[model samples]
Target: MEHPHPMKDFLVRAADLPWVPQGSSNVWFKPLRISPATGSWVNLLKVAKSGVVNRHRHLAEVEGWVVQGHWHYLEHDWQAEPGAYVYEPPGDVHTLVADVDDPDHPMLTLFSIHGPIEYMDETGEVAYVETAETKLRRYHDYCREQGIAPHEIVF
Candidate 1:
């Protein structure tokens, strides 16, 4: 099926999007902020590498689909596999967790969230320390180690 929107090229390479899960097990997330003009807000994320997307809330009603791999949230651990979909209402606490023994093997995820979702910093801080930049660095190193020409970290 062809997606109607004019597909915007991914300027950032996968190697540049380092996946990381903060101590919450195997949970690595590469967030792609979508254009609002697209009518529905969305973002592509890579999960299932020993990571945990701690419980969080959103202001707008949200929905999601699992392109691949699996995740568990709330008291229920639902696997939105390659062809599954999940609709999470606004303000619902979503505790997402993904893990893979081999860092070389990671689960792929495509999530389209309507409205806006914000991370409820349990640490009481403004932002999480290990973030986009940190992951980028890790991805760069991973690419270099794997003999893939490293992609310039473009912002």
Candidate 2:
């Protein structure tokens, strides 16, 4: 199937997306489409260089395209290099860390989705978990090292 956005120029410049949305850098992301409510989706990342993304799983079969640098998660440490694509099945829980040497290098990715992803809690209970706020606080130290503000609470 062919999907066309409202405007042909519905694209986000790498420079435009914030390094940290509202000063939270851990889960900073920008959607590619002009209006992100629709099904077609993409995200830009300015994640921490070294930290745990906590033990949470997703309902959406998440897919990623690495635009720059790399990262390591569980089962497999994905090298989100300049040009590479990685896919994670539903219920996959793991951590994420940017390349050690260079933290400023942002990860520009395109994440297509059918719906919002779900996260597993500490007891392995499946529920809706919004990672934005929690991821920020969880990796505050790492964010500080990178000069990005920390998340408000631990999710």
Candidate 3:
């Protein structure tokens, strides 16, 4: 049995994607999908032990699934370990911190983020804003600098 029409889809192995640095926080992200039309992006984010992901507030909802190691928000008491699912509502500002003393395991999580994330300074001012477009640009820039052809991730 064959379908009448061919499937219109994009596919790429995760191993083929490059891990682009997410600023100077000892964090990196491998972009899986980036949709400018919906202002959403999916990425696998990796954080080194004792790394800080900055204080940020999402303009829309964000979802995450821990794949390895553990982490927690400075504003929250509970920790998210491997297999843990997390949902962050819009406008909730929090600082993400990787396990402080875990030398063996760094935190790795897959996240589906919608809209832009505003990184706030200590004075509560918006220092930077990251959006799907910006993420795509960063991925392209990183791949270009590394002399690696970037996989098609934007849709």
Candidate 4:
């Protein structure tokens, strides 16, 4: 049996992707898909022990699945460990923290974001914004700086 449009399906080895720093020494991301049409993106976020992903609000829906280690939001009491799933509705603000005991294994989560994220300052002001396009540009910029050929992740 032959299936049509097989090329439309993407198979990626996540391990083969380079980790791009997220303006932090211990936080990085590996983008899997960047969809400009829907203003969405999917990526794996890695945070080392004691790393904080900062306080941010999602302008749209977002979902994540913990793939490695453990993490939790400072605003919430529950912790997310391996195999745990998380969902964030629009306008939900929270600060992500990774305080795992293991120093060698960082926390990794695969996230599917449907819109932009507003990084907030201490006074609740929007300090910066991150979107699918910005993430794509960041990946490319990191690749160029490291002398690595950028992969085509745009959809």
Compared with the true structure, all predictions reach lDDT values of 0.55, 0.53, 0.91, 0.90
lDDT of 4 by residue, 50-142 (tens): 878879999999999999998889999899999999999999999998976776888989999999999999899999999988999899999
TM-score of 2: 0.59
TM-score of 3: 0.91
Candidate ranking under lDDT, highest first, comes to: 3, 4, 1, 2
How well does each candidate superpose onto the true structure, as a TM-score?
0.53, 0.59, 0.91, 0.93
Q: Residue-wise lDDT of candidate 1 within 9-103, one digit each (tens)?
A: 55755445445343345554554443434334334566546667755665556666666666666557556556677777766766676644556
Q: What ordering of candidates by TM-score runs from best to worst? A: 4, 3, 2, 1
Best by TM-score: 4
Q: List, in order, the clash count of every candidate structure.
A: 8, 2, 0, 0
Residue 134, model 2: lDDT of 41
Per-residue lDDT tens digits for candidate 2, residues 26-124, read: 556543332224333344665645544455566567777776766777657345676788787876776565564556665445655434455556776
Model 1 stretches astray by more than 4 angstroms: 1-33, 36-40, 123-155
Error of 2 at 51 (Å): 1.6
Best by lDDT: 3
Cα distance off (Å), candidate 2, residue 105: 2.5
